[model samples]
Target: MNEQLVLRVLGMDCAACEQRLAYAVRRVEGVRYAVADHGTGVLEVHLMPGTDREAVAARVVEAGFTVTGVETR
Candidate 1:
């Protein structure tokens, strides 16, 4: 089964921010897909096996965004 990570990210004020953050998240090794909505401040990622959720979150932080909450399913 696949895993999904839902995060509440902060400081994304525009579409460009969404693109930038989405790009960064997509670069993480086990990420299959990623989308960020600045309007909702929500970032959703589909991850494959061997993916570390924390690592994904770290990538988000490294991209100049703040991750305030996280959920998995």
Candidate 2:
């Protein structure tokens, strides 16, 4: 029951911003992997079953960015 979460992140201006956000997202519980692209302002995350989406978004925000939107698939 793993899931993929696609998030549109704001305020990402460079590769460093992407890396920081990706690292933060990966630290959240149940996150299997995360990748953030500065060019697209998107973060794609692979999460384990039952991962809390809000918590993930919060983590992204805490990492110094904004989560504009989220989609689960």
In lDDT terms, which candidate is top? 1
Candidate 2: tens digits of C-alpha lDDT, residues 17-72: 98899999999999999999999999999999998989999998899898889998
Q: How much is the lDDT of residue 48 in candidate 2?
A: 97
For candidate 1, write residues 1-73 as lDDT tens digits.
Answer: 6799999999999999999999999999989999999999999999998799988999999999999999987
- What candidate 1 gets wrong by more than 4 Å, as runs, is none
Cα distance off (Å), candidate 1, residue 45: 0.1
| Model 2 local distance difference test score | 0.93
**Candidate 2: which stretches are off by over 4 Å?**
none
